[model samples]
Target: MPNTQQLQDLTTQVRRDILRMVHKVNSGHPGGSLGCAEFFVSLYQNIMDRKETFDMDGIGEDLFFLSNGHISPVFYSVLARSGYFPVNELNTFRLINSRLQGHPTTHEGLPGVRVASGSLGQGFSVALGAAETKKLNHDKHLVYSLHGDGELQEGQNWEGIMYAAANNIDNIISTIDLNGQQIDGATDDVLPMGSLRAKFEAFGWTVVDIEQGNDIDAILTGMAEAKALTGKGKPVCVLLKTVMGNGVDFMMHTHAWHGKAPNDEQLEIGLAQNPETLGDY
Candidate 1:
């Protein structure tokens, strides 16, 4: 297992990968990708007990689904750097016939992806089904999923949340990236779903809050708490409060970069802020 410093270094590199990948394609979502870099690094490197090899069924191994799949840049970067595929393959992002599409697709045989997301409000349903399947098969491993705060505006997510609690799907932990920014503008300005904590509790799910979602140690600690809350009869929800475009000074706290790629000069500035922690793809 990697220590805290190593995970932090990998997070910085993941941020760089997000910037470069989107900049090259001249299109893609970077704000949420950057905000959730630390969470991805911490989950893949330290939290989930993944197998050495990849498979679709994933029996006896923890599985992850990206509900908000537009952040494929960060997911692709972290998966590649974590050895799911060759790091150089990142260059093909959003290209014609590339496995690394704008949103993750399973039909293309992407190693780490298991669902076709980005349609919003469906990932939680898929994850609950997986969690229930694990129980049916007697597999003790967990199912994990991530959702965007803005994505929760979709009505299907609420049904999935209600279903998970009703069915006692305790082995899954679904995290919401509470970054406050989405494509149009701030989530509040768009459509505020007030008090996510209270809502989750009302739905009969256990909720854990990582107040400092961008910090590596805070994420690790909060996830540990979430893991501890599993299997007692309710699903777990982690409210990860992160800053959109966290590492880049100009991009922080703004929705302007939600799905916009930085220009040459902006890319240079973003890269300079993160520095080359591990070699770039």
Candidate 2:
């Protein structure tokens, strides 16, 4: 297991990778990716029960799915740095013919990723299916999924939520990256996720809140609590309060940076706030 300092360093490196990769590609969502950096780092580095050797079936091991696939930079960085692939492969991110596409896919046989999830609101259903399969196979490991706050506007997510609750798919922990911004605009302006906690609670999910989604320690503790809440014959939902484009001053407090890559000057400014800790990919 990685120590707390190592996890912190890994989170920093993942943040650096998010910026560098997006800056290199000149296209990709940095806001959400940066916001979820610490969460992903903590999962891949310290929390998840994953294996070095990839397995498609995910039998006897934990599984994670990225519902809002626009955050591919952070996911790819964490996976590569977690020994899923070569860290140098990050240079090919979003490039033509690269396994690391703008959105994550299992088609390229990516070792760590099992689903292709650019379309929003599908990950929850997919995670429920995985959980059901785990029960069918008599496996004890859990399934995890992450969704965007704005993405919850899709109707399929509600259907999945209802299905999971009704069917008692309790071995899955679903998280919402409640950064309050999407590519088009603010979530409230676009379609406010009014009282998401209450909404999930009404849906029969055991809801938990993470006040500081950007902090590694806070995220770790929240995830541990979320894990404990699982398998109680109810689905778990974590409403993660995260700042869009966290750790970068100019990128925060606005939705303009949601899908925009930082220009040369802005890139330098963003990088200044997040120093290269474990060396940029």
Best by lDDT: 1
Question: How do the residues 1-281 of candidate 1 rate in per-residue lDDT, one tens digit apiece?
Answer: 99999998999999999999999989999999999999999999999999978999999899999999998999999999989999999999999989998999997998999989989989999999999999999999999999999999999999999999998999999999999988889899999999999999999999999999999999999999999999899999999999999999999999998999999999999999999999998
lDDT of 2 by residue, 1-281 (tens): 88778888888778788888989989999989989988898888888897789989989899999999999999999999989999999999999999998999988887899999998889998999999999999998999999999999999999999999999999999999998888778889988878999999999999999999988889989999999988899999999999988889888878887888988898888888878888876
Worst 10 residues of 1 by lDDT: 180-189
Distance from true location, Cα of 116 in model 1, Å: 0.6
CA error at residue 194 for candidate 1, angstroms? 0.9
TM-score of 1: 0.99
Give candidate 2 misplaced runs (Cα > 4 Å): none
In model 1, the runs with Cα more than 4 Å from the true position are none
C-alpha positional error of residue 70 in candidate 1 after TM-score superposition, expressed in Å: 0.5
